[model samples]
Target: MRRELICVVQHRLHDKRMGDEVMNIPRLGVGLQFNPSLMDWFPFLDQSLDALEILFDGMMAPLDGPGLMLPTMVQTMDEVVARFPLVGHSNYGGDFGFDELASTPAVRRHVPLARAFGVPWVSNHCFYSDDSWCDVWSSPLQFTQAEVDRLAVRARALQDAYGVPLAHENAAYYRTCPGSDMPEEDFLARLVEQAGTWLHLDLHNLYANAQNHGAAGYSITRFLDTIPLDRIACIHMAGGRWLDNQYHDLHDTPVVEPVWDLLDDVLSRAHPGAVILEYETESLHHHDGVLDIPRSIDAILADLERARSAWDKAYGPGNRQTTRAEAA
Candidate 1:
């Protein structure tokens, strides 16, 4: 029966007032995209969105009690999505990222897991940056357009087979491939059009990608232009962890400026779905060296607030009048 509910995702974008409903701004709400202990920290988050990283599968498999045993997450997400925020799937596996789980036995049985978890949709990183697996090339962008088409065909098949509404988030690439055929936006737009799905649209990643290449490469503004506003299912907001000279997308930090600019651009163009910052770098049950958890969370929450203000300026009170004035 729950699996039947998963079908709603297919029909959601078609609903008459989806645009208006999506644009309705809400007050402050904290959404968590990583870790369960966050529940203990932010009690009020019960009303916010909670997305689960597929790497969290390890916890879901081995059930037990409340402390931390990787309880059956599919069922858990169903229950949580019912109450506070629902659970959606992030990338499967560790920080490196992997998408093969759609074919794995455990994930296969959990297609209804999204519905069961009360999750309306599921999201994964769009680009191929799986550090754990050597089979796929190091850089997804490096591949030719034909190569991507070949891969998208298979990827979309997995999306359909999984039965959950699926979308891909762009990832931060350190450098551009010398011989890459298509631009990142082209690849992303094609993937969405072909799959008949939407995107998670990680604005921060777009900034990073643009900075690495050049203006000619992947500018955030150009990236936004490439994606049709109607097809953007949901959006993700995250802070990039500045390590060494490169930026790592760790959600623990407050959002930086460039990403904020991109978010403004996106909100001006598309609507927001569950916007949970990827803040999952806390201690795992006090076992992994618990540090200032609240402080870290506050940083992300503050960033979320800033983004809300930016959205307001673009589409909220002031923008509405501006549009009216221009039209009149």
Candidate 2:
């Protein structure tokens, strides 16, 4: 079974890589957080999307348990992979960000998906996902060297198991963990260094952090300047809503203007492998019982159009890497 699975995995990976080659550098795309109601939007999105970032946890089944996914979920995911350049983004049950042991379960789930899709890369957040102790606040763990070592071990393990490159994203935090010495950007740099993983830079997360926690003379530009651009594997651009005086990483909305500017800044400095527009629609149902499929699709297409326009201006046909002064 393992040998057969390996063959299947390699075959799929080859097919997707071929598609990516034709598509060329810096794939413009969106997240496919699978939902029954969103099926109608796929045909429209697949028309132009260069790739789809698949949430790994959503497509799995236990194969023998009650909480496990239905058998058909695998088949459905296979269909989705065959149609698009799919990248795995593992939530990894949230604890992996702090402890290497906690990452094992999440990595086990991701390995099969990586093989199934022939994914070239997989990514996860730099912070924990489930917080039993702190529910009211966005409490991101401290930027400590111990955390960096733990994250590196998990990242390397994932890359080995998946036989693909791995990346970890910088998460948004409303409150800093007590007694952290390193700045956020410096911590990211160290983590990438130790893990030998690429950076899955999430622009909106930085937008939120800067808004809520930025220090004096601090800005997104400073944050960008702190990290090595060459390590970037992909970039996530999304919108958030301000709730209770904090910017939430809620994906129900379109890409806001400030996030776009940050994306442009990154494009100017580095040529990332992909730029993904993340939109979550499950939350929309709360406002109304039904999902407005067409409206949601239209909004993303519009957002992608704006992104393409900005992308073209910054790193389009010419590979323009001019400073603002030069462009002016």
Candidate 3:
């Protein structure tokens, strides 16, 4: 009963025995989307932890060879395993919501990290943006199940090659919202039913859709009810901005009020097995001032904590744990 499946090219399959050990990601984890001023190609860097978004480029031959790849950037999953109290970069998702770099092999090839990073999930945004990706699609907001399926096919192929599942987040499209073959909810649900991979539920995107259109462009509750919950692997929460009467998904500041409400609704229904704060690294520190990162990170962390608390109330503490030892 599958519809569209996408995957990457097959390689020497990684041994499960070689799999990274499972670790519990705290409700609040740091985002690696920021580009640090300092970086060099080396191994076992003790200082690069400051750089955000764990730089992963083509240079790293043996992932665990003599040296670390982008030492000043990526904190090896093994190194960060027990060193840092915060969850590792496994929670990182390329917020290329509107930036499509399909033709760029390195950008498109990031999914293989499921093994390299020991992450339970690898994900990307379903919404297309930026002119750089127009070559792959007719338009950014080309909203149609057919269009989404085309995109999903590419993602499925990556999953196949890596022997790991991939999840696509429902994107908030204000610039190019297209009328779908069916309602957005049904369209998204059918996509998951057709693809065996999984879904990265973004309550923030859903909230944006409702706000831009009437509350019915997609029903927060109905969207939840329709999607095959079993296909969902994680939940994503983030904030945005509004200016000149337009709502933009900045993923920078704290989540808005409506999105927070939608998240509570999500916690009530199917509690996400794992939740992460999708934030922009640009918010890390403004060279011109005393950055307000403490507040921003705290907001994101608080929302994630709230999600966990609500989850405990609904599913009970016994059902919850950070490690994926049992699932894998």
Cα RMSD of all models vs. native, in order, equals 8.3, 7.0, 9.5
Cα-lDDT of candidate 3? 0.48
Deviating ranges (above 4 Å) for candidate 3: 1-71, 75-78, 83-108, 129-141, 177-179, 281-291, 297-301, 322-328
Scanning candidate 1 in windows of ten residues, the lowest lDDT window is 20-29
lDDT, ranked from best to worst = 2, 1, 3
Output the better candidate (1/3) by lDDT: 1
lDDT of 3 by residue, 237-328 (tens): 67776657766666756656676676666666654445555665435322233235555445545655665565556656544443222334
Could you give candidate 1's per-residue lDDT for residues 1-328 as a string of tens digits? 2453344434432442322233222222224455664555754333333333332344444222232223344454445433453435545422223445443423443344443443455666544544243433334445367656665665566556445556666767666666877777777788777766667777667666665566555566677787766665556666555468665655555566676677666666666554555555552112233447666555555665675466567656433222334457
* Inter-residue clash pairs, candidate 1: 46-84, 59-70, 77-117, 78-116, 78-117, 78-118, 81-86
lDDT of 2: 0.65
Per-residue CA lDDT of model 2 for 68-144, tens digit only, reads 33465655654555555677776544435443443344554557666666666777777664423133235565788
TM-score of each: 0.67, 0.78, 0.64
In angstroms, the error of model 1 at 291 is 8.8
Q: Which ten residues in a row have the lowest lDDT in candidate 2?
A: 317-326
Model 1 TM-score on a 0 to 1 scale: 0.67
> C-alpha displacement of 31 in model 2, angstroms?
6.8
Candidate numbers, best TM-score first, in rank order: 2, 1, 3
